[model samples]
Target chain A: MAQATLDIPANKIWGGGTSPFGASYGKLMMWFFLLSDAFSFSSLLVALGYARHVHADTWPLVENVFFHFPLTHAHLPLLYVGLMTFILIISSVTMVLAVDAGHTNNKKGVIFWLGLTVVGGLVFLGSQAWEWYTFIVGGEGVVKSIIVDGEVQKVLVQGANLQNNEYGHTLFANFFFFITGFHGFHVFSGVVINAIVLYQATQGVFERRGHYEMVEKAGLYWHFVDLVWVFVFTFFYLL
Target chain B: MNHVEDQSLHYSRPHSRTPEESKAVRKKILVVTGLLSLITVVEILIGVYFSKTHVGEGTWTLIKWFYIILTLVKAGYIVLVFMHLGDENKSLRTTVLLPMVLVIYLIFIALFEGEVLIQYVQEFMK
Candidate 1:
């Protein structure tokens, strides 16, 4: 029988009482969670891409689909989505600031930045809700063919749902709802978590604990949300 | 609890950094944000321009590739900086990144299989 080594220092390789990955257990767990989440998102996106490829000729142009801007009837392709992307990215920046503040044990700074992050998340969520509403209640209209009583009839399709959409393929709207809706849910949860963390920061909980690791962990989640949006913007909107 | 007594706790450690360090960190954060925004703007511009003008099929495909590359760049930067992955140990970084190879493989198989199915169906119909 092999004898176990007994003289290894606690901080050395294969030693006990050390963070093997050089990060706290909670943070590493968060990374693993994010990695798994990334797979889920990517699988959805790849499926979307496959659907688009299959329906390439008939698929609605993304720019034409998302052309309408708020308060202006003018067609501004990608303007609103772009603004939403910017808002989310800026929120990620604020989240970083909040994490940095946590590192320095600045209670006021953590509260302020985390508050901004929550607000940014809320704004992005609100924008997504509006976008979904617009999509469901579509603008203009596309003529769709239907068979009625053994005769072909021409009918206009407006708005979107599981069954019908103004866009060319129903799969387009399905993927839109499924992918973005899932991401929007993530943003929603992130905002709620930020709110709780902000409240705790206001109470100086992390200060008392002598670490702001909670903020860092939350920041990782927020940034991952933003990162996923980047791919969504490209695959769903830009391409 | 008194301030002095609070300081005696094991959890108490001075976390305050020099103003210069804080400023530098803030500047780095701003720079990354600027880069992300710039990439978004470029993506939008290319999309709009291509939508307006009739481009060759090859050119359009190239533009799509460009968009994917740019998006990846932005994602990498956000993960590295905002997630603080860049500051982590090499083994930790690898632990996070190594699994991504599987994701890429998944995407490739999905796209390839989808294309083959589409082609088969088209041939059958013809």
Candidate 2:
């Protein structure tokens, strides 16, 4: 430890007053904040796994539950969700492009890429809304056992709600809503943030500051949102 | 310290890359994009097809683990390449990634307790 400390130059020493991470304060804070956010998302997914495990016998097969496609009569399992995944991935690419353009101080490039990214985000959010609608409305009604007049009787149930689900188990719908709702909210906020950043870029905020760090920061967030969705898609739909 | 007046530091200048470097960056971005897309396609195909057609429970379990591993690969690329965490200093990278290790613990405990609880419910509550 003494030799290592002595090998460092005076200016390089992190004596409680320097950016030891070689990053701007804002960027470092953004990373830490994202780390914390990752924990929150992890816990939520963990809870979903726990609940699914406890009710493993009754848990619905996810592919069967999410097979519907827009403007189609045929049953297509995992098609719509797959499309949504592609949409988010494409947006993440555009976001990284925007950050790359920012690195080169290319304002027009940043605007173009950022604009595309915003559109991609909106499209993904719209797709998610459609998915949620299909989920809440469900498909064909199924007969389920329910207590009626102090006796258990088979009754036809439709769709999904907090109380019950036409799907295999109620927890299935609950977890779907909670996990995807949380992720959807993140995408919504990411879009809003990207739009604001786009406006700021147009108004020459980052250009005047002589750096596009804000875009890079927002790009980090957008990528994090996409990252979370990757897990959600696997655990919720694919698994 | 006159840090504000010193233009020699060039602290406010935007990063400039050579033409070759720019080309490399663009190529890397495109490659990562293609890789991510391909992995997603493979995942979808496996989920949609193999989940229905896979022969046995062992094979199905293998496919599930494959799905998880592929998802992690995709995630690593996003964080490391797209998010540029790969370019950050080692200290910063460690600071960000170390805490995520706890998530493995969380997953293990939750699933274990779930199995135990379900068994308990079967034995007692039922």
Candidate 3:
């Protein structure tokens, strides 16, 4: 009897008479998908770390690079990022609550938590926008420069580092914008999708079916977004 | 009752797991969340204040590893607590997480490669 039950055999949907494994087939695949995404993000971050190491002298100091109004007249370190981090963490919390509500069949709780999660996501995106604004519109304005013979030259030339100006390379800003912007895009998309799910859920979409895989899947995506932020925070902001 | 009856009863999905003891799980998750936030702040503080202070030579190297470890700790917590990977069955977790272990090993090798090359570059800085 135990063998028969454990045999969950191949899921008949696949014509195998069982799911090929335990647990929801779709969710298992989502986990696999996330694993691949994690690798891709890690590769990008590792490259950033390598570049930072190779350009140590020319890399813009991040603490001094990022801005937050209350801290610095011009460039403050880590304050905006800290806020963003908190917002993301809070969003993750709300997402968990949403999942909990889904599990417990609480439609109202699901909507509320999902709504809060989306709001937190928006806040994080707003923080990213401010961060990007500071980057694009630098204190001295965008210094189009290039590295010349080991010294940073302040002229818009080909193959030169824009991250560091006469102060540092300009390539630093390029990477910073590209990497963070990409992650911000992920957060933005996640928020949109989450809102859609929440909206559908509020309309009693998944509740009648007596299942909550949508919430679980959305939670998976949210966790991935948060996970990527950890790498970004460690390599880009902290390092 | 023979083994078959016992086995049948044990294998069946409990008619009742549905009323999610959400209250307990909620409390557990909140505690985990608070701990996660605190650790992140502490890690950042260490990076901010200690990195600038002039300690003995090689402190930067030590601190670099320290920061990385702390970040790893954060990652572990997020995976285990927030992602529900912790309570998952060990076999499933291993199947899913094995890739991550391999990636970290590769990252370790990559770090050494970059570090060695950077040291060579820094030698010419003076």
On DockQ, the leading prediction is 2
**Candidate 2 structure quality by residue, lDDT tens digits, B12-39:** 2467888999999999999999999999
Off by over 4 Å in 2: A1-5, A9-12, A147-154, B1-13, B52-54
- Report how far off residue A133 is in candidate 2 (Å): 0.7
Q: Chain A TM-score for model 1, please? A: 0.93
Worst 10 residues of 2 chain A by lDDT: A3-12
- Ranked by TM-score from best down, the candidates are 2, 1, 3
User: Candidate 3: where are CA atoms >4 Å away?
Assistant: A1-21, A70-76, A141-167, B1-20, B53-57, B112-126
lDDT tens digits, residue span A1-239, model 3: 36334443233233443343345656677789888888878887877777776677767666666645544585445756876888898899899888777766678888999999999999888888876665555555444544689986776432223434332565576677678878888898899989999889988977665666678778888988998898798888887
Candidate 2, pairs of clashing residues: none
lDDT of 2 by residue, A1-239 (tens): 46444676543567745566777777878899999999999999999989988988889888778999999878888889999999999999999999889888899999999999999999999999999999889878899998889999998888888868898888888888899999999999999999999999999988878888889889999999999999999988888
Per-residue lDDT tens digits for candidate 1, residues A5-121, read 787655446454466677766788899999999989989998898888878877888888898778999889999999999999999999998888878778888899999999999
Between prediction 1 and prediction 2, the one with superior DockQ is 2
Q: Candidate 3's residue-wise lDDT over B1-126, tens digit each?
A: 453222212221223233356567878888978987897788667766765434554887787777788778888888887777786556558778888876777678777888898888779776
How well does each candidate superpose onto the true structure, as a TM-score?
0.92, 0.93, 0.81
TM-score of chain A of each: 0.93, 0.93, 0.82
Interface C-alpha root-mean-square deviation of candidate 2: 2.7
Worst 10 residues of 1 chain A by lDDT: A8-17
Higher-lDDT candidate of 1 and 3: 1
